[model samples]
Target: MEKPTRLALLKEIAEFLNEETETYDMMQGALKFLIDGSDFTTGWIFFIDNEGNHGLVSDTNLPGALVKNNCQYMQEGTCWCVQAYSNEKLTKASNIINCSRINLATKAHYQETDGITHHATVPLRSGREQFGLLNVATPYTKSYSEEDLELLESVAFQIGSAIKRIWLTDQEKEAARINERNRLARDLHDSVNQMLFSVKLTAHAAKAMSKEEMSKNAFNTIETTSQQAVNEMRALIWQLKPIGLEHGLINALSSYSEMMKLNLNVQVDGLINVPSLIEENVYRILQEAINNVKKHAHTDEIYLKLSQQQNYLNIEFEDNGSGFNINHNTEHVSHGLNNMRQRVKMINGKINIQSSYEQGTKINLIIPIKVD
Candidate 1:
């Protein structure tokens, strides 16, 4: 490519990346632009995190037959370039190392094209953190020169910066969402919830003073509706605010149980301080479980046990109630249970539910804790 054309291609890639909303889309755009404008026949990118875990984030024009196998490898395979980058051995663009994924793909296809047998990779980094690796493959046998290396390194730098920007933007959006939720919670609790409570109290007094049977019944209905409304509004506020978790997870669960009129027995055996992310997830999972019991358990008492044992946090919730079978394929199954499972999985936790006809239900969850 000529000087003007090369410059224009780089500029176009940057502009397209800037317009992308998601990191995956940005990476796909970058790879596609590189293959079309440069001499590269195929391209792919991989992201590595602090845990030495690497996975493919984007790729360009993979063969239909190889897509499934390639994706599996992308998630499970790690190349020499990635290892070198992680070990701080390969920082600049280089063609000295061969990609393991490409080698595997070539071997799998006996009639492989000679155009894209190997690839060169550059580490994408921002400051001290390695964001990922950018790989470009060509058919020509000629080795990549210093100029090619420099150009690839420049492209890597741009990609790293874009990834960082996307992260920051997502953080800002989340913060804004939390702030808005807090504001709404405060307004609802202070205004609507308070009024509902007052209305219930007034109805109770009217019911007591009324002598006519019809009037007393009407007052009783008013009081019941107002109480239900107040309870629902308060629950909504908790969902929006979640400030109760700051006091402690145990306390939050106790308070929520009281609000739902369920007799809750809580047992704590060990230290409870954990990361906020873990704490929030545990709280939500328990909340969903408690809710499921309230709606379907047909029992008034719930027993909860929380403990930390050997680098893992264990939680148990048991209730003696009308039990039902768990059908995984049924759409009518409790969404609450499904949501609880999803939350546990997000934190890399394990959950088990035991239930049978007239046998009651037991929920056991275990989550790994990061020890400092």
Candidate 2:
């Protein structure tokens, strides 16, 4: 190709690949056009960045793509493109090197055009910056022309412009996601958790100053109201901010031990060991089970145990207090129990309640570790 014609091709590329959103796909189609219209069979595009690393951008009709945090791939075994990149060569290559496979890639990538044999890759450079690369390869020993190099450079200018646009768009989306998470955290702390604390304080005061004195009826009412407030706060804490197991299930359970002792006047023990995500769900389920014990079961003594068995984590919560009919409608228990069921479903677990009038309510939560 003549100099005037070569310059015109670059200008044409700029016009076609300049769109804001279509840059990535434009880079993809441009590589295909270079091989099909120019003197090459297989084409690979790469960008040599500030740190002298290869960043594979796009390819034509290939299955495996090279994954990169920020780099490209080298095709020549001795890496002609690296040298061209370092030297900032306008257009150059070895006749012998083009006839051989470019094992110059740092590692074997999924996008290896296994059928490619002879190849030519041009390092894309603009002053001190190495933007990207463009190349054409063939299975036969035929030599590529100088005309091909000029055309590849033309494609490089357009493809490089498109790549820069893609990078900017990605950066914008990531920044937006970070901002959203920050806003969510602030809302939870400022509104939800603070209100729960106020409710807890008021309930505790009512329990203490109530004129129940020693009357079982008035005393029981005061105790139940305070306990209900505490349970509500526990659920709110779990929702507002899920503690990342820094405070394990045992710590969460221990906080409730005094309540079991005071309300039912029973002895309770808790054991726990499991992975973070699954175990967190277990903590929530047990908390709800304890709330149920206080609200309706009227049990004097309660037992809560958590430990890992063969294939699953077992949670046993038993109460010696007045048991209720398990067959009775669970609609009234929807808030806590339903929430537990929904959470258990997410972690692939099961909850079994065994109780009737005198039998006492025992909640068994089994969470499977190995889920498909």
TM-score for each model? 0.70, 0.42
- lDDT tens string, model 2, 169-263? 64455346445644665576567656655655665666567666555455556556656765675555444434443676666565554444523
Instruction: Quote model 2's TM-score.
Output: 0.42
Task: Identify the runs in model 1 with alpha carbons over 4 angstroms from their true place.
Answer: 1-4, 64-66, 112-114, 140-142, 253-372
Give the deviation of candidate 2 from the true structure as CA RMSD.
17.5
TM for candidate 1 is 0.70
Clashes of 1: 0
Off by over 4 Å in 2: 1-16, 19-26, 36-39, 49-57, 61-78, 87-117, 125-128, 139-142, 176-184, 203-372
Q: What Cα-based lDDT does every candidate model obtain? A: 0.77, 0.57
Candidate 1 per-residue lDDT over residues 220-326, each given as its tens digit = 99999999999788779988867577799998888888888998999999787777767867887888877777888799899999999877899999999887887
Name the top lDDT candidate.
1
